[model samples]
Target: MDTLKRDVLSQRVQQVRPSGIRKFFDIINTMPNVISLGVGEPDFVTPEHIRQAGIESIQQGRTRYTSNSGILELREEIAALFQRLYGLTYDPLSQVLVTVGVSEGVDLAMRTIIDPGDEVIAPDPGYVAYEADIIFAGGVPVPVPTYAKYDFAVRAAEIEAAITPRTKMILLGNPNNPTGAVIPREELAAIAKLAIEHDLIVVSDEVYSQLVYGTEHVSIAAMPQMQERTIILDGFSKAYAMTGWRVGYVLAPEHILSAMLKVHQYAIMCAGTAAQEAALQALRHGDADVKRMHDDYARRGRMFVDGLNRIGLACSEPRGAFYAFPYVGNTGMSDEEFAEKLLFEEEVALVPGSSFGNAGKNYVRATYCTAYDKLEEALIRIERFVKKHA
Candidate 1:
C-alpha cells in the first residue's frame, strides 16, 4: 500500500510539458561529434570589464544581501540606462524591483497581476517559458500567432479579437524569442490603443532589445500612456553576455510593484549581491563592448539568414535577436521530423518550431550564437539533408 502511494505534485505542475527545446539537447548530449546549432548561450564570454566588476565587488566585501528592493545606486543606474537607451523613466526607488533574472521578473509580474482563469495574450511560436509560466500561475495562455509574410508582426485586430472580459494582461516580447520577430511601432501603437480602450495591463519583455539588427528598440513604456500600465522586464544577461549572472529587473506601476516586491521578498530575497554590483558597472560603463557584441549578432544574422534562404529554406530575415527562424516546409517534413532527421543523419542540432507552439509546427529555429565556421558547417550538412529528403 505504501509503495503504491500516489505522487504529490500539483495539477498545474502535471499540465506543463518539460522544455521542448531541452528535450532535443538531452538526446543530443549523448551523440558524439554533433555540431549543434541548438546552443542557446552566446559563444562569447562575459566581457572582461563586467567580469572584473563582479570580482572587485567580492574583494571589496560587497557580498552581503542587498536591501530586499536592491541597492538604490543600482536602481538609479537602471533608470538612467532605460532613459538613455529607450527613453523611458521608471522611478528607481518605488517602481523598480530587482529579481533573479528577466525570467523571475516575468514570474512575479504575472503572479502579482493575474487572477486564476485570467486570459494571458502571449505570442504563439513564442518563448516556451511564457506559456509554461502562465499555466503554472493558473492563467490561460492565449497564443497570438504572428506570420512570416508580415515579418511576424503582431496585428492589433488579432489582439483585439483575442481579448475577453477575463483577459487580464498581454505578455509582449519586443524582438521576440524563438521567432526573432520584432513588433513594429505602428502595430505596437494599435495594441496600446486596444489596451487603453479595453483596460489591459502590458507585460513587455525587452530582454533582446539591444540585440536589434538595423533598428533601435522601442519600449512600450516609451509611450507615456502605456508606461503607467506597462511592466518592463530587462536585464544584463544578453546585452552584457552575463547570462549566468542571474541579474534582471522589472519596472512597473507603484502599486503593482509594491505587490510584486512581496513575492520577490518571499521567493528570492534579492538578486546576487555581486551580480547586482556587476550589472550596475556594466550599465554605467560597458556600452562600447555591448555595442560590439550587438554588431556581431547583426552581421551573423545576415550571414545565417542568407545561408538559410540560399539553401532553399524560407527564413524570415530576423531583424533582431541572434536566432534565425526558418520554415522547414520545403522538405515537406514537420518541424520535429526535420530537426530529428537532420540530427541523426547529419549530426547537426536545431530546435523544431512545434516546440514553441502550434504556429511553429512547420518551422525550425537556428541560432547564430555559434561560431561563423560552425554555422557554415551546419548549413552544409542541412543542404545535404534537405536534398536527400527531397
Candidate 2:
C-alpha cells in the first residue's frame, strides 16, 4: 500500500506536535450538544457586500487565475489599508504580497528565511500556528513567556535574553491569541531597537489589528529603522470575518517580499480569485462593517471578562482581539481537566491554557467571538459549573 512511509520528513516535521487547540476541539465535537468557545474565529458571517462581491466574481467568470502576488487592485487595497489604519506605507508593487491566509503568510515568511538550526523567538502563550510553522520551516522556536501581571505584554529584556548567534527572527502576535494583550508604543519601540541591535527580522502577526477594544495598534513596520526588516502578517480573516475565505497578505522589504513571492508562486500560486476580490470589497466598502464588528467585540469582551471575574475566575480585560483568557485555578482541576469538565458539565468548550504553552498552563482561552446570548449563557453555565466544582 502507498501508506508505507517513504523518506524521513526533513527531521522538522516529526518534531512538531498537533495543534493542542484543534486536538481538544476534535474531542469536544463528538460530545452531544456542546457549545464551543475554544476556537478564536468570529461567529459573524462575512459581510453581505463582501460575499456579494465574491459571488459577482464567480458570475463574471473572474476565476481563471489572478497574478501570483494577487490582483494588483487587491494588493493596492491592502497597501492602502495599511496606510489608512496604521499610518504605515507599503508599496503594492514590491512591498506587499497577498497570501492564501495569514497561515500561509506565516508559512511563506518562515520558509523563505529560515535555514536549518536557525532560531525564531516568539511569545510563549503565543499563536499556535506561529510555533508550528517555525518548526516546519526548520527553525528552532524559543518562546519568551508573557505573564498576567503585565497583561501579557512582551518584555524587551525577555526578548534580549533569548538571543543567540542562531537567532534569526522574533515573531510577535500582538493583541496576542490566548491572552489578548497588545504591545504598547514604548514596548514596540524597545522591541524594534532590540531587533535592530541584534540584526534580527521582525515578523509581526497583526491579524487581530482591527479587533482592538479601544487601544491603538502600532505597526512595528511603522518604525523608521524597523520598516525594512519587519514583515507584517495580516489579513481579512480577523478583521472582516473572512476566515473561511483564506485571504491574508505579507508586507516586507522588497528582497524578502521577492523571496516569499517565489515561495508563494511555486507552492500556492495565488490566493483565491473570488476571495481576493471579496477582501478588496471589504477594504473598500466595509469600513462601517469593520467598525461595527469591533464595537460588538468590545462589548462582548467586556461582558465575558466581567462575567468570568464575577465567577472568581479573573480574566484580564482584553484590549485587543475577541478572546478572554481566565485563570481556571478555582476549578480545582488541571487545565485539561478543567476544560473537559467544563465541556461535559457546563456545555462550554474552551482551549486549555497548556494547549498554548507551559506559561498558559493554569488558564483557559475563551473567545467572545461567539454571539452575546451564547456568551451570556456560557457564562451562566460556567458559574454553575464553578460552584459545583468549588
Worst 10 residues of 1 by lDDT: 1-10
Overall lDDT per candidate, in order of appearance: 0.87, 0.89
Candidate 1 residue spans exceeding 4 A from truth: none
* lDDT value, residue 112 of candidate 2: 94
Query: Could you tell me the lDDT of residue 244 within candidate 2?
Result: 97
Residue pairs with clashing backbones, model 1: none
TM-score of 2: 0.97
Q: Which candidate is the best by TM-score?
A: 1
Candidate 2 residue-wise lDDT, 219-298, digit = tens: 88888698889999999898799999999999999999999999999999899899999998998899899899998988
Write out the backbone clash pairs for model 2: none
Best by lDDT: 2
lDDT of 1: 0.87
